[model samples]
Target: MSAVTVGQELASVPYDELIKNILLAMVAAQNEANASFIEGINDLVGTEVKIKYKEDSTEKEISGNALAFGILPTLLQIQSGIIEIKMAITLQQTREFQVGVKARMGFRVFSASVDAKYQNTYSYKVEGSSLVRIQVAPAPPPQPLMRAIEYIASKTAPTIP
Candidate 1:
């Protein structure tokens, strides 16, 4: 008896299709009952605080839709504070956006780098077929809310437990 090895296979998915699917899924998830849909993510990576979203309205919609989906995405806009640590596409199809550290405070730190553009072509394979994969960029690093809490804490003295 001879042992034969077969390579794994992948699925075929189009970039545009993938993006549309993700957007649809997001909408669907938000529409789902008792489903918590997060439109935005906030966190404290370091000294800098960052907020990201395709549009601020997305957050409002998420908040309003929270009742059905159980989660809402909020639009975050930090006027003065830290800089954006990471940039993600979240949903990419016709256009390509790089994910990385960008500006700080109000000043632009790094020049925008175009790793891939709308013309760029990329593909993925799954289940023995090419799967269209939309580049879902990582959410921006969350801003630290500890400072606000600390400020409040400092204002108020600790009481006995």
Candidate 2:
């Protein structure tokens, strides 16, 4: 059988809260130039575009800090019913895990590492005085393996005894 491993879970924050916070962080990061463009688009689109995370938490705690990373376009252009913002923010964190094993004969201990990344996309329109139709797309999912461990079971079940 293959070995089983799991990562550490956050203490008390809900997933939705995490995503909301991250999205807010992304919006706050936008500079004046891009913010103006976002506002303009909101005016054109009737409905506001917002970002929603499919999972519980889009923000991962790595090391000791809470970080949000993403990409935004340096220049934004609204033309022919299409709006584009071009830039990127790459955020990542590393965590460590400890594993312990006890058996009839002895005990063993080891460590594993896990890393996570979050990428955000900023594009929006200005409707009236409010920024509407804000769309934020998360980057691809984080990889599962931050570290790898391998071990042989004692005698491999003895070949069916």
Candidate 3:
């Protein structure tokens, strides 16, 4: 409703020019917000902090995206010998961030991956003993008392005819 009102108010401007103006305004607003947010991040750069965001970069004509992470060292005891990672955020500062954006954007759209599988899966209770069969089952682990008793009997028992 408010958007509609604002659009109606801007009707005096030409349609194409109005759209361009709106986009320009949006970009300006985004940059200002980002600068302020980065400044905040810079404040706690030397401290232990974990921040998660999406990184996008373009090199030549190719572009890629990934989950960007920033972690600060937690061990203050070893600060003398250890190198700590810090973040710097400056409001309205002139900086060309070619590395990528560090903003937290919600609900990024991604294409479904084609049958990517996870690694390190183990199944203990297999049914088929053959070469080409896969089985999955859940079995309880052996009890410690029974194992101890078996061990003692084996060690102490004498041979019988």
lDDT of 1 by residue, 1-161 (tens): 12211211122233344345556665454345212212131221112322334464553212211122222244333223222211122221221243552323332211111123311322222222222333343334434543543443344322222
Kindly list the per-residue Cα lDDT of model 2 for residues 102-158, writing each as its tens digit: 222332222111112111111212221111133565433223311110111121111
Model 2 residue 49 lDDT? 28
TM-score of each: 0.21, 0.19, 0.23
Ten contiguous residues minimizing lDDT sum, candidate 3: 111-120
Report the lDDT tens digits of candidate 3 across residue range 3-96. 2232223223332343355456555655565556445444433233232344475222221111112221221111112122121111222134
Candidate 2: residue 81 Cα off by (Å)? 19
lDDT for model 3: 0.30
lDDT of each: 0.30, 0.29, 0.30
Which regions of candidate 1 are displaced past 4 Å?
Answer: 1-14, 20-128, 132-141, 159-161
Model 2 lDDT, residue 144, Cα: 30
